[model samples]
Target: MLHNFAGNIEMYGILDAIASGPIEALTSENSTMVGVGMSMEGIEQNPIVYDLMSEMAFQHKKVDVKAWIELYIARRYGRSSPLIRDAWNILYHTVYNCTDEAYEKNRDVIVAFPDVNPSLISSPLEMYPHYGKPTSRRAILREKKNAYEQPHLWYSTSEVIKALELFIASGKELSASNTYGYDLVDLTRQSLAKYANELFLKIIDAYKFKDVDKVTSLSQKFLDLVEDMDTLLACHDGFLLGPWLESAKQLAQNEEEEKQFEWNARTQITMWFDNTEEEASLLRDYGNKYWSGLLRDYYGPRAAVYFKILIESVENGEDFRLHKWRREWIKLTNNWQSSRKLFQVKSSGNAVSISRSLYNKYLRSES
Candidate 1:
């Protein structure tokens, strides 16, 4: 049997749930086995969640959390230092320190569909359909306010920047460690992901004011950052979407089977299910990812379509056509989901170098 405590971020409470069992249910003749599992919703981008889970397992089995962290640092970098520990402590208190009421993981604006006026909608229909009366719109809007976690930053971005700085400072000592390299890239990725949300808000503001030049320029920078992020993630095998889809194909014996499996794999992460005119797949983008090829191809194109339409509307003196944009967006998403294009499965580039370059390019202080 599996126990699900994945929604809330209460680590200790989850551990307690894992450790506790039904009374009068255990005996020498019958044993109960429980497993702890994490959702893949954002796991690829948040490796620290795995680390947290491992810490939970160790704590549940009579190991101290502090000792586990120390050992983890040692094994992760083949050595530990005040710099590393200090950096990790900041991370523990900030990004890793989710409140009990917070979502399982933080969400990113990149995964959210672009809106001229951003508000979390209850149903896809309300956003796309104009036939609904004001009363019906009000009802639909209130329907799913808390259905799932919305995109939010629970911690300070400055603190995350400090953690990234510490990681970069320790690079000379841990450069040769693959685990350290992964952590470096992952930390940088996290830092920039948070910053991307800021950029997105700016984009929304520019769109709101109908600043054609500012919108055009900001959109380029946003897409460029997405491309750079994809490149950085492609440096690690764990961050590639290619191997994921390729593995699905490899499992098939025949070409027809391979095509089916590949389609299924793509669909699972993209639409979740087919969307219809009257109903939008509420689960669409629930599996939104930060994987390499996916960012460049899928998410990037979707945002590009949004910007293109927005800019055209401003130039042509037309109202932003929500339904038309949604139709175009769906077509773009479906084309990607159904395409047979294969992405590179193997990783390339140097993680440390890429991280440093990005730090200088995006995060370094000008003063």
Candidate 2:
């Protein structure tokens, strides 16, 4: 995100003066919120600008509105032009008062034009503050009730699907030129090849027979097939396939590729803890290689806490430690528990002693 705030600050001051309100009230002190709102405003005004900003925002997780406006004006007009500030002011006022009525009135013009003032697309909903002084529990519950009582603004599932179909059809029609058709075909092929290779590897891994020779032979054949597919992919000189084919070819040639591939393919393997020696042995082997390393690298100080849970599960011979270490890992990673749950190894034991020791180690490390 761009941080050139000079323009925004000047704009905000002017806005504050017009309203005769505190300047700080017009602008958020929170940098992230300000950036998000400004970026969204910038995008809504111009679809081309919106497309670029949205892509950058989704990838980089932030946007600088002032810098973007400055660059945008310089590109469209000229560098160090006075009209830049004037145009920005006009756009700002338009966006500041943007409402549902305005959107309805201007919808046709916005859809038909390449350049749009951001205000034309602004939604009042986006202006709502995300955070502020804490409210009482009762007030919060009341707010929730009021929200639920209001008509739902989001599209239903079926409506969304229909909308997506329309979008795809429109995109295809718009890009029906020979050049674009070739690009689309190459993109589709590359995407299919990538998915197919991933699915093939997954199928091979799912067969748990410890026959190393068979697995190795099948893996080698799969790799060869992938290489051949990539070779065919390279014949398509479209932009979409060029980058993907190049990457796949590099992967095929690189000797150290396997290690990188292994890392990419690393997935959690869940084992239910049974007190049997056989279960213990399997758990130890798998845990040491995959689970232990993941926890240490990702969780750092809390790694030992996860390790303790694994040990405890095994010692107790319990069918499963419900939630257990895998749950904590999900919390730390802030990801869905689905993948982590797959790797859950359930074992029975209230290994308080082990947990205590690990907790102490974590504390010491933190200190």
Candidate 3:
């Protein structure tokens, strides 16, 4: 979103002065331009320059002024002409070079400024104030509050659903004519995988579910689904789930209580199931019979064959094959949930069965 305005010498002078020292020197055109250029060039070379540019181009309200300033600076330095084109190039390269990292760093900004187009630069004055000084602490605080209050700052359940809707609507177009649709599908899938594996764990901890064992079992199933989709659910461990888990850990009254919860959730599902006959019977029926059949029907004939293998292995007490099928099931479940496509179906039960069947099919073919 860099503007690079060629014609505004005075504005450039003011920019230069602001860059060089205090706002007081902004009165002189020559000094301002020089100050602005020096400051801008320095910004351009920063490791985070691309991120800052993305913020300006894709997120900020004062992009027009920023664009103008960028153009003015670029033109003054004879770096490039047609500031819009330069801006486009900058944007393209930034996206291309950083790839997913760019999105991670500037997702909040991009979502906030979804309508941004680098080609829309008409005036420098429109782009200037966003980079300038604040009048009061109250104004700064207001801006911060506004930023935190923005609805699209983080991926919410609604946004995830919308992304899925786009994926389903695009349908065959994604695989055939529409490259953008395909990209959207891929991006949405990636985002969902991240959310499922990372954010999901946080939700479990936050809610402190009484049926901790059931939660753990469900979580494992979800993870399995991810693997079945042939997608990696791993995020930058330090930045993703780690922060949420750490926050949850901090919330616990004592380490012993935290360990107790973790043990109950992760290791006691089977024991809990044994104690609850009705729930156990329902799970067994659903997991072994109903869901298994549903999976075969949902994924198609090839997948049905795989489900048959899994059933046979389990029924005949073939430990190795049973183990293999179990692993494959987990992987498929993870993939299905991670895609965020499960919501398209009305029934969670039906979705689970379908996912299991598809995964079974994938495994049989791979084997």
Candidate 4:
């Protein structure tokens, strides 16, 4: 079975569930397996999550994450020790082990974009049907009260930052060995995203305070992280957009068919499932991926547009026109070839060692 069926971040344990089968059925000897479908991208994001699940299938055992991680660290890298286990402990209890009820708002950086103005109903990361359409003034007043509720408030901010550092250090420890390249790429991707999430919240705070200079500075930095993320993911063949697009192209017999197939591949990782134009937003960003081309080409431009509006609105002393922007965003979401910008097809630097030291630099209070 899978989690996040509604299409946001699922717990890292769904990997475990896939291997464990139903709790009642665990007593039976029947064969069970998981497809982990719609995962056309790289295996880099969460190898540990799935590796544990795979072992669960054969061992048919429950995970004492504490104990299992020791073995995991040893196997993935060439070594393991107290440092390794300590880091995994933090992840197991927090980000990896949360339930929907307990951590309702804990979301990725991109997913929390709507917090800037909860009334907007959609972030630049997505184009929700409710975003462009007009709503009553009563609804606006309601959102004003709740807009402060953001996903980043899920964990002890300092602790989460520490866990991200742990991942980066783990990447460094394993770099020279390079025992499992997939794990390296995945760790870097996670570190980059965690760092971005931290900055994302700061940007929102800056905007709240009308710190235009801070907004402009942090906005550029956040986009830089997104761009760097694309570079990191490019190390893996599965994370490259060229092959992803080509896979779609191979299924087409004509130019019209080609366009449709391309749209299918792109949407599968984005909006997901089949929906009409009016209902084009079901599960938006639910399956969001940071593939080579999608990050630099698709997500980057969207962020640029958002910060531009914020900076301009602040400069001119006028309110931001989110609806107008949403209309334009909707148009881009429909088109596959919004630009011809070239993106890195291969990763630069050692994805592991290069991202190694980021732990100290990013993990801290926002002071």
Candidate 5:
């Protein structure tokens, strides 16, 4: 499987570092490695990213990432421009160059907290949000791990933000073309995700401080960010939640079987291996998603509970018992689901145009 961002590059020359294989192996005796495999999981799901990587399976010559990405955008949108190529060139040197600690550094605490530091057996409320004694929570771990992986620990956020702006500007030029619509969405998703990651900390901090008003405001604002995401994704089926849900339903012989398969699909993005019994359930929500249906229905509800409890606790001058509510949240999600009771799947507008408009409206509204 191909590797992705592991850590931040605090110093120059790290971009050249990932591609060089050991000289010993490259020059050594017979090697039988024909090709490589890629697990699409834990990836951005951008066809271009995966497509280019797949192209490498057959590429023999040592390819430069800049040139390779240039060829990709040229072929991808049925047009080529220096702006396009250069935007990707910057991407390669920024987010695309994330260190191995990248994933761990950018871990989403709201969804991935339960398994942040897994135990052989996790107790109820064992990992619930609390401020007092320092625990081995992902939030805690992230604070330590981040120091080694960001602007100082990883890539400069300002630079990545600029690259995103450039990519978005190029996307506006191809507003009428369908060939690269999904690609544009992928770029837009990455841009918005960057903004969201920055907001995550502020949201959690409000919760930690029991700042009820701030938590209520930020929680709703956070949910709206995903809603904005769902709107962008509705432009194409590639990002729609319907296909994933439908695939699970199609393989089922009946409603019960459908529910079973649906549960796994829904569970995968939500509770993950959320079984209260298994140790490996430690991986719960590791691959959490913000798809149309999941974001509007599942994630939004989970967050609303916290917002409600926190705000109410602040008003009542009492501590919020996270244990009681977390169990209810678990019970609410522990099932196979079907329905778009939240967002649409069919295309209703031009994907690229939406990107150009929303890129400024939502993702950069913070500016």
Candidate 6:
């Protein structure tokens, strides 16, 4: 909710703009009240953004977004200062500003399989055999390029970093505010995760040059960054994967039902659909999470396998066995889905302290 405020507002703004012409075309005789169909609720798992949207929707007249943001700050934090204003203002224009056609959500590259040239195949007829036409397959690939594979950031990274710094600086004033702490951890998590993508891109470039030493170093850094991200998320219950899995299990009336439901939840985030060696699931890693336990336990090991294969190929001067690698990776994924390992449902550690530790470790150098 706090993380995706910009995307929620973007949907509102886009609909509002589209309705403007139709609204103006109506004459004095036309008594039709055309309200844009906007949903104030989402599956964000946090209500702060939804609460703000609900307030805006309750207004019987046109809403001023800027004014609403101020009210939100006051209502959410119980008080406001220039530091808080500056931070949120930066967020409003940068990270939270989603006027472009790029993905509405931030891309988590840590879970994505590593490749020398990481992208959706332009010609995925073989990859998506279900699609008959080449053009149709290409269209799917294009959409996936923006939404899933190789996601791009629409905002300036430096501006968001500055905003995070300001957000952390306001901690002294917002110490007692629990909401502030949540946002702090979320902002920190996003900033670091974005950097992980940058690291991934660098690793790809290193692999291209066959620089084994650089690849080795960058791969370790990438893994370490993911481990730290898992640590940050573990501090907040909102970001854990445990409760979501547990809830899925608890909904079952019998053991068989429990197993099926658990499988469904696990498969959605991982494979998404059944696939064989002849046909692969293009939606793999599409529903990846930045949740605790998921990072260290799942995504990290998967990436490690890819890195190991990449290093071996680079050193041996042999071509990458894409087919063999895919088979092994899919097997690993399938095995994890069947395992009955229970994750920690409750959160631990202080959000503010962990965020500060991460900021000092990761973002301080950038500042």
Candidate 1, residue 123: the lDDT equals 31
Write the candidate numbers in order of decreasing TM-score.
6, 1, 5, 4, 3, 2
- Point out the worst 10-residue segment of candidate 6 by lDDT: 5-14
- Over 32-118, each residue of candidate 2 has an lDDT whose tens digit, in order, gives 332222322111122223334334423332344455555654444334244324434333333222222211111111011101112
Q: What are the clashing pairs of model 4?
A: 44-186
Tens digits of per-residue lDDT for model 5, 1-367: 4443322111112333333332223445896554556653355453554565566555555557676677777677778777767766776776566443433323443333322111121222222233222133445345444221121124444555555566667765765566567656766765666555555556556655667788678777877877777677677666666766678768999989887786666666655554553232544455565455666666666666656666677678776656655665666566323332324546666776777777777656433
* RMSD in angstroms between candidate 1 and the native structure over all alpha carbons: 7.9
Decoy 5 TM-score against native? 0.74
lDDT-wise, the better of 1 and 5 is 1
lDDT (C-alpha, whole model) for all candidates = 0.65, 0.28, 0.29, 0.55, 0.55, 0.66
Candidate 1 residue-wise lDDT, 1-367, digit = tens: 2212222111111322223222223322565635445544223344444665544433434434455566778877899988888887777666555444433433565765544323232232322232211123233334545433434445556766787888888888998887887788778887777567667656656766778899799888888988998999898887788988998999999999998999888887777665874245766765666678988988888889888887887788787777777888788877787899979898888887788788888777611
Consecutive 10-residue window with the lowest summed lDDT within model 2:
105-114
Better of 1 and 3 by TM-score: 1
What's the alpha carbon RMSD for model 5?
Answer: 7.3
**What are the RMSDs of all candidates, in order?**
7.9, 23.2, 21.8, 7.7, 7.3, 7.3
In terms of lDDT, model 1 sits at 0.65
Which candidate has the top score in TM-score?
6
Off by over 4 Å in 3: 1-155, 197-199, 202-212, 228-367
Q: Can you write out model 3's per-residue Cα lDDT over 1-367, one digit (the tens) per residue? A: 2321211100011222122232334434665322222223112122223333433323323334345545543443334334323333332232222212111222211111111111122121222122212123233334453212111112232333333343334333323322222233233333333333332333233223233344445444544444433221111121112232234345568977655443332222111233221122222111111111122222223233233443343345452243444344334433332221111111112222232343243222221
TM-score of every model? 0.78, 0.21, 0.26, 0.70, 0.74, 0.80
Q: Which of candidates 3 and 5 reaches a greater TM-score?
A: 5
